[model samples]
Target: MMNIQKWLKHLSFASMAGMFLILVMGALVTKTESGRGCGDDWPLCNGKFVPAYTIESFIEYSHRFVVGVVGLILLATTIMVFLYSKRKDAKWYVGGAMLFTVLQAILGAMAVVWPQSSAVLALHFGFSLLSFAFTLLLYLVYTRFGGAMNKGDGTRLTSGVRWAVWGVLIYSYVVVYLGAFVRHTEAVGGCIGWPLCNGQVIPEMAGGTAIVFIHRVAAALLGLSILTLFLFIRAQASRDSAVYQAALYSLILVTLQILSGGFVTLAIGYDIYLLASLLHAMLVSFLFGVLCYLGIASVQTAERSSAKAYAASRLP
Candidate 1:
């Protein structure tokens, strides 16, 4: 018989992978302008359970089908974790993952059926990202509890390191929202130049140009924040391999994302932007996963610190 713990861990990883694919497919659907491919159909393509043979229709419909399948997988994983895991932490993570997945699906359907403004559609990406993060946390909990867990020598975090982690995580989410806003507003190519919109260091703050400019500014800030985070981790917390490695991975992904964002603008001018945009979206999803992992690690570190402090007090 397969061990239930091992099975649950695998299930958690599977759910996270599925969520990542859903995010990528969603980017494809939007980049290809497939949002209207089904002609306002909700839960069906062009009023049919099986969509017809059209490129846009197939892309959008397939994304919906994949999302549906992933939702079921997440629900099942949540139930199994809740039933079998001994840790209350595991239960909470699984429950949160299930809730976020459900909310994401509802928002996705509403985006299709309702007259969603660009702002609302952008919010959809934010919801999807949150769902992805929760799934990642669930995976982390499963591994930490089910496998040979490593507690990282119980290193104490300095105030600066702690605040850096917290600040970068918060700022990363803001950058994510701005990226989604850029997509939902269809302003991906609104600015024809990188570092500057329209070859100017500062473009006129007017119309969609402002949205694109804001997103660029957020991207630059996010890149700097991640870089600073990595440097801090290397200098102060290098002994904590897990934390240091997570910070390094996040830094690399964020850098790649920034490069892809610029390439997307340039490629779109050459009419090859769709693929670049898809890659850009995939990087953001992966970055979200890494950030979520870091968040979980931070929490565990804090709990360990609290326990040590309490024990030291009792010794007195």
Candidate 2:
């Protein structure tokens, strides 16, 4: 039984890792302008299972292969969880993950087949990230249900702290969308500078510049929000080590993301910064996973506290 549980955990982790890699490869496809390399092919490259030699076609086709493999792994993981896990939460998470993974695949195919505008292409990243988030959540459920992890018992948070954390997580998604927009609209180099658009504190609201500027503003807000959350975590009621560590790691990633963003804008230049941009995207995906975990942890803590209070009242 212990061995089975460990196997399930490993499978779950592998599925999530595959999903993360798919996201990175999708970024590469977009960054390299290989989206049309397959020429509107849904699941095929250039009307062939294996396209005739071409760099763009190879990149796009390889991404498709990765996506297919990840999808299969996710399906297997979901089935395994359903069969072996007795926890209702774990079962539900698995079901939801399967559903989102399907939806993500559909969106990806549509983007290739249809004449999707930049906005729609931007949504592709958002949807992919959501799928990744669900997979991470499923992994956490597996870990906890298999007794590989323990829930943290921490002091009850004031309502203010709860609201603040929730707000930060929600706003972070907005920032993510704006960043995707910057990429899809080809506005990554619109400003040509970091912390300021061109030489001005405010960039001219024209062409891709406006979208890039909005992204910058959103990023700034996200940074402030995370900083606030970090300070609150430091000062608030004692937290479990896992919670503390996750929050600390999130702050660090956000800081690194900011630095990477600056480097892409200054040192690398958009034309050759595909790797850096993709790294930025990957970091944000990981950050979202951490945020989702923290959100669930907060809710679980609240529910346990409420149950304890009710039980004590009945005893009195």
Task: Evaluate all candidate structures by whole-model CA lDDT and list the values in order.
Answer: 0.79, 0.78
Question: Model 1 over residues 1-316: C-alpha lDDT tens digits?
Answer: 2499788889889988988888888888777888888888888889999978899998988988999999899888888887887767667777777777788788888878887888778777777787787777777765543221224435456667777787888888888888888888887767887766899888888877888999898889889988987887777665435676788899999999999988888887566777888888989888977876776666556667888889999995
**Lowest lDDT 10-residue stretch of candidate 2:** 144-153
Q: Pick the candidate with the highest lDDT.
A: 1
Name the runs in model 1 displaced over 4 angstroms: 144-153
Using alpha carbons, what is the TM-score of model 1? 0.93
Clashing pairs in 2: none
Q: Where does model 2 exceed 4 Å of error?
A: 142-152, 268-272
All candidates' TM-scores?
0.93, 0.93
Work out how many backbone clashes candidate 2 has: 0
